[model samples]
Target: MIRTLVISISSLFLCLFFTACVRDTDFDQAEDISLSPIMELDLIYFNLQASDFYDTINGTPILTLRDTTEIKFLDDSTLQESLKRADFYFKFTNSIPRSFQVDFEFLSEENNITYETGTAVEQGEVSTPVITEFTHIVEGEAISQLTLANKVVVSVTIPSSNENLQGTLNMKSKTTYFLEY
Candidate 1:
């Protein structure tokens, strides 16, 4: 009888302890949950420069414009294609008075990728790449990168007879990037 009484008391106490810990207070309040989801947008701006015309940029043109290609992190959607700028240019001062056409190419490892500037370029835009002759080079190449989500581009120019041309030309380039978000 003693043992039975002790076990019953302990069990009863345990039951009450657990039960008391689970009491619900009825405050009667409505829930105001927010439905909008939050997302991260990392916009990495890159100050682009024309390091080299032949091998440096020619080999990996897209990598040259690495900053402009990082526009895919604005939303929740995964990046299937990389965004690119098309209004690329170069500025040059020709020693001799001559007329020549300059160009550039943005090559990416990915397939079917293209680059195109959504809007037109203005004159004397600094900090960013302006499609000009010497910005990249005006000797033989015709243009530099100027497009979005593109792969390859080619600028063509002929030799000048007298003085070399000196100015800036806003050209386009091809860039192929993949969205992995």
Candidate 2:
């Protein structure tokens, strides 16, 4: 008798489970989905001493110093397609007594300049450091030119320098990217 009762209940539950209603799912809604992500990355940093701008052997000052850094990720096809906007930030801490000009040149693989920007750093004393900040935003048509760059050249220009020049000039920079797909 117990066995028959157990079998009856099991049959009834199975019948009810199979008869439950579920709403229809529309897979086409997935087509309207999109993703947007923002990313920030460190671009470059450098520290230069006063002596770096002076030529000890030649007994003259080197007015400018340039450094090149590869930015190959900007050339990626995926990044080029999804990147909607980009912003570059540079911060300069100057303890040197001479004002300077800093330039950023974005170049393509063929050494062509795609974009160029710069900032002027104010003169400061060794006892008191001066901070200067600069921002460059690329959107709309400018984004196209930025995507073509595979390298960046940084040039620091000083007005004058001597063996007795004292203090340092430091820089920190970063880039923020906005992407949508």
lDDT of 2 at 122: 90
Superposed on all Cα atoms, the candidates' RMSDs to the truth, in angstroms, are 13.4, 3.4
Q: Kindly report which residue stretches of model 2 are placed more than 4 angstroms away from their true locations once superposed.
A: 1-26
Among all windows of 10 consecutive residues in model 2, the one with the lowest summed lDDT is: 19-28
Tens digits of per-residue lDDT for model 1, 1-181: 9999999999999998887753465445335332333222321111222222123433432212221232322221222222221122333432222233433334433533333222222333233323333222111111222222234343333342212223332333322232221
Best candidate according to lDDT: 2
Q: What TM-score does candidate 2 reach?
A: 0.85
For all candidates in order, the CA lDDT equals: 0.32, 0.93
Count clashes in each candidate, considering only residues at least 3 apart in sequence or on different chains: 51, 0
Q: Per-residue CA lDDT of candidate 2, range 50-161, in tens?
A: 9999999999999999999999999788888889999999999999999999998999999999988898999979999999999989899888888899999999999999
